[model samples]
Target: MSSARPDIVVAIDGPSGSGKSSTSRGVASRLGLRYLDTGAQFRAVTHWMLSHDVDLADPDAIAARAAEPQLQSGTDPLQPTITVDGEDVSVAIRGEAVTAAVSPVSAVPEVRARLLDLQRRIIGDGGIVVEGRDIGSVVAPDADVKVYLTADAAARAARRAAEEGGSDLAATQASLASRDQIDSGRATAPLVLADGAVHLDSTYLSLDEVIDKIVSLVP
Candidate 1:
C-alpha cells in the first residue's frame, strides 16, 4: 500500500503461463492485502460441470447450470483456496481436464455474469489483488494498479511446463496457444489490457523483479 493510496486494488490480467498468478500472489502477500484468483473460479465451475457430465460444448447448457455450484474463494495469499459446494477443490481445479474446459465454461455469458457478481463482492472496497484473463479489462477496470502481464509463447510454455513437473514443452505451447485463441476470440469480456493499464513483458523478468516493479508503481 502507498501512502497516498488507500484500499488499493491490484488487477493482474494475462494469458495462461504469463505468471499472473505468481506475481499477483507475491505482490499481495508483500503488501499485506487479500488475493483472489479468478481463473480458479472458472476452473472450479468446469470441475463441477465435468463431475456432473454437463455438455461443455453447448453454451446454453453451461449457462443454465452456472449458478448451481456454490463457489467460495479464500483470500489468503499464502493459501488461496477455491471450493465448490463446500468441497475444497484447489488441486482438482488445476487438472488438465479442467484446464481444457475452463475457457469454454468461462466464456458463457451467464457463467461470467455469475462469477462477476462474486468477484465484485470479494473485491469490495479493494484491499486485494485479483488475477485472471479479464480482471483488468472487466472485473477491476478501476483498480488502483492494473497490470497486463505478457510473455512470448515459448517463455510462457516453458514456465508452465516447469510448473507442471517438466511436462512436454511442445504440447504445453500448443495448449497455451489454444487457450489464448479461445480466451481472446470470445465475444464476451475477452482477454485484453484495460485502458491505462501498465503492460509488463515478463518473458525475461524474474518473478521477484516483476513484483518489485509493480510494488514500486503504487504511489
Candidate 2:
C-alpha cells in the first residue's frame, strides 16, 4: 500500500450506496490519512432535526433550526464517530427515519451552509479522504485527487441492502432511486461529477479493487 503525502486530499463523491463510505475509509486507512463521511454528518443533522420535532415537509422550519445541532465528526477511518450536541449518534443516524428524511433536510440551504463550514474546518490542510454527494463539486473542488464513484442502479441497491443487513432489495432500490432524484435536482450544491474528477464505475469491482484504484490516483 502507498502512504499518503501529508498535504494530499482525496475527494470522493457519488450517490448513496455507491461505496463512497467504504471506498473512502479503505483508501484513507490504507494510505494513512484521516477520513470524513460527509453523508453521515448530514444524516446526523437530520437525526437531530427529527429528534427536535422539526417539520420534515417545511423547508423553512428546517432552515430556521439548522444551526441548532452541534455536530462533531471523528476523522479516524477505522473508528469514525459522529456526535450531535455532545451525544453520540453514529448509529442512530443510520436508522430508517433519518434515512427517509435526510434528503429534504440536506436540501435546505441553511443546513448546507451550516455543514459546509464544519466540513471545511474538518478538511483543513488536507491529508483526509472526504466522501459525500458534493465533496468534489462543491466541498473540495481543488482537492489533489477527485473521484466520482458510481454503479448500476440494481447493483447499488443490492449493495446498500446488504450493508443494511437484509433490507428488502426492491424497497431499497426504490429508496435509493428517490434519493438520487432529490439529490440531483436540489438547487443548492446538487450532486454532479466534478470537472477533472476520474469517473469510476464500480459495478464490477470488489471493494479492495475500488480502494486500490483510488489510492493509486493520489499525487
Candidate 3:
C-alpha cells in the first residue's frame, strides 16, 4: 500500500543503543520529515501492563486488552512524545523496570499486531522516519528507504550505559545480548534485515556520518 501523499517514508531498524532514535530524529528534522519511535510504543504498552498489574507472560490477557490503553505518539522530529492513557510515559518507559519487562510484552503476537497497526496508521499520513527492531522488515516493507543500523555490542552497551546513568558495562552487555536473543528469536515479526535495505554499522561511524548516508539515500 503506497501513500497518496508526496512525503517520503524512511524505515530504520536496529538494536538498542545503535543510535536509531537519535539518528532518526536528526535526519527527519533536517529533512523536514516526521519521526516515529516504534520502540517507545512498545514501552508504552509495557508501562501500562506494569501499572495495571497484568502478568507479562499471559499472552491472552495482553491480547484481550491490547486496545484498551489510549496510545498517542507525536511525530514531531524536534521533540517526539509518547503518552499512554493521558500519562506522559516518555521517561517512565525507559526505567529499569519497564526495560526489563518490555521484551516479554513486545514478544506477544497480540501486542506486536496492535502496535504494528498503530505504526502503519501513523506512517500512512506519510513523511516519517520510523525506527524500531522490525520496521523495515515487517512494519513498512514498502518504505521509500530502508536502513538497517548496527554497532559492536561493546559500543552499543557503552552508549546505553551512558544514557542510563553509569550502568555496569558487564550487566549492560548481558542485557543487550539477552534482548537481541529475545527480539530475534520471537515467533512474531522477528528482527531481520529487510530486502534491499542499506546496512550500516555504526560502531565506527559518527552520528552525523550515519545521518548523512541516510540523507543521501533519500529519493
Candidate 4:
C-alpha cells in the first residue's frame, strides 16, 4: 500500500464531451481517491438560477445569489450527488433548461469566485480528481498532476449526441461549438491548457485506454 496520505490531487481540464468526467471518475475509483465534478457544481448553481428566474445576463444578480443555495457534491465515483438549497439536484441540473443557461451563469465572475472558493476547500481536505474547464488553469494550478484532454469537434459532438440518446447531430455540433467559444473566451478562468499539463487527444482512444494513461501518471 502507498504510505502517502492520498492528498495528491489530479486536475483534469477539457472542453465539453471530451470524456474527462468519465476518465476522472474511473481513475479516482481505481486509485482510491475522491472525485469532484466542478461542472456539476456550476450546473447545480445554474439549476438554481433557472428555478428562481434569475437574469443570467446580469453578473450582479448571479453573484448576489451565489451563496443562496447550499450546494453539496458527493465524492463517490459509483454514484455522485449534487444538492442545491438542500434539495437533491443530480437530475434537475442536467435538464435542457439548465444546460442552455449554464454557460452564461458560469461565465459570471462572482459565480466563478464563489464556486472556486468551494472547490479549493474540497481539494484542501484530501485527495481528489477534479474535472472542469479551468481546474488546472485556475482552481488547482499547483495540482500534483494536470491533464488537458481534447478531441476533434465532430467526434466530441457525436459522442455527446450519443450519450443524449438520439440528439440532432447538426444542432449538437453547433451547441458544442458555442459552448467551446464561451468557455474558452470567458474573462474569468477561461478554458486553456495549463503550463506543463499533459495533453491527451482522446478522439481515437478507448475509455480504458484513456484511464490507463491517466493512472500511469498518478504517483
RMSD of each: 1.4, 0.7, 3.1, 1.6
Clashing pairs in 2: none
- Candidate 1 per-residue lDDT, tens place, 1-219, comes to 433244899888999999999999999888888999999999999999999999999999988899899999999999999899999999998888998899999899999999999999999988898999888788888888889999999999999999999999999999999999999999999998789899999999999999999898875
* Candidate 4 TM-score, true structure as reference: 0.96
Model 4 regions lying over 4 Å from their true place: 1-5
- Expressed as tens digits, the lDDT of each residue in 1-219 for candidate 2 is 569799889999999889998899999999999999999989999999999999989999999999899999999999999999999998899899999999999999999999999999999998999999899899999999999999999999999999899899999999999999999999999999999999999999999999989987987
lDDT of 3: 0.90
The lDDT values for all models are 0.92, 0.94, 0.90, 0.89
lDDT (Cα, 0-100) at 154 in candidate 1 = 98
User: How displaced is residue 75 in candidate 2, in Å?
Assistant: 0.5
Best by TM-score: 2
Clashes of 4: 0
Which candidate order results from sorting by lDDT in descending order? 2, 1, 3, 4
Q: Write the per-residue lDDT of candidate 3 for residues 125-164, one digit (tens) a residue.
A: 5788899999888999888899999999999999999999
What's the distance in Å from true for residue 10, model 1? 0.6
**Ten contiguous residues minimizing lDDT sum, candidate 4:** 1-10
lDDT of 4 at 175: 96
